[model samples]
Target chain A: MATILVHVMPKPEILDPQGKAVGAALPRLGFDGISQVRQGKRFELTVDGEVTDEVLANVRKAAETLLSNPVIEDVVQVKVVREGGCGCGGHGHGAGKAEKDLLA
Target chain B: MATILVHVMPKPEILDPQGKAVGAALPRLGFDGISQVRQGKRFELTVDGEVTDEVLANVRKAAETLLSNPVIEDVVQVKVVREGGCGCGGHGHGAGKAEKDLLA
Candidate 1:
């Protein structure tokens, strides 16, 4: 199993009214020190089996075709933070049951 | 300077059409192994000065009030990845120029 983290942000050229609004409000709310408050989203995904290059490529395509607009969004960076191990210093398929149901 | 990372997702009770759509498309796209493909966003903010506990709390409140919907979203985790240093083992006021302009 692998855990992937992804971030999506608007293209730099695009006007981020949400970000701008937050920027304007931060100071008024007593956060005078806060500025340039651009906001985005984060996802933590637990995928069954190894998240290899091919698997991640398909995931990126899915993100592009459905999750975000290619014209307005920049990159869909995918990073594998942890790899599956039984804690015995070896591959663990035994506990994949929980993840299987999630993926199923 | 400090870099804060935030992740936002639909409350588990809410319907995630984007996540569902991507989940359905994954298998057909030949990524048969992929399942439970939920999508969210990530942000990396470079803030000038120290992001103390009070500063971080203010940031979280701002995020709750403007960036995210408290009713529909949960958690505004702000992690300070890096602290100000001249990289010379001391507080760096000299090079905060870039971040200051951004936060300004």
Candidate 2:
């Protein structure tokens, strides 16, 4: 299996209230020097096969279409972190149940 | 200014409903081969100065305590993306108003 990471962030023009709240709370909680905090979404996708160029292209299309709202968010990254892992190693299938349901 | 990226994800044992929904929706939407999807948070922290060891330590503390819920979420990554920018170039301060309010 291959693991792909997709990072989605708010558009620079958009207001991120959640991030703003966290930024405000940081100083009150004694974490200083951080001037700005913008919160976004990260997705880890486990692919069933090798992370070939075709797979990357498909993943990027998915990232832009389903993973982010282009009006307010941007898909900043879609990179492969792991490629061609055996099914029985430390990268165990966490979505076995879901896969069964989908394939059934 | 410096930019630090913090990635927080659901614990492997935890249930990620958001991710499951996305995974289920993918094949229906014509994106295939993805077996699992895990959703998480990505925070871009724009710091006012250089990202020194002390700053990294502080950010790590903040990430664990405020950025992620240690019970269900894990701070998987805390890395510096950009270090010591002049602040007047393409990397303009997007959080200017927030920074001013916080500094005020």
Taking the tens digit of each residue's C-alpha lDDT, what string does model 2 give over A7-70?
Answer: 7888889999999999999999999999999999988888986666677777888888899997
- Local lDDT at B7 for model 2: 75
DockQ of each: 0.26, 0.38
The residue-by-residue lDDT of candidate 1 on A37-104, one tens digit each, is 55554554557887666777765665555555778765434444456421111112111222211110
- What is the C-alpha lDDT profile of model 2 across B43-86, one tens digit per residue? 88888866677788888899889999999987776656555431
Assess each prediction's global lDDT (C-alpha) against the native: 0.52, 0.72
Residue A92 error for model 1, in Å? 23
Candidate 1 Cα errors over 4 Å, as ranges: A81-104, B28-31, B44-46, B83-104
Q: Could you give me the TM-score of model 2 versus the true structure?
A: 0.79
**Full-model lDDT, candidate 1:** 0.52
Best by DockQ: 2
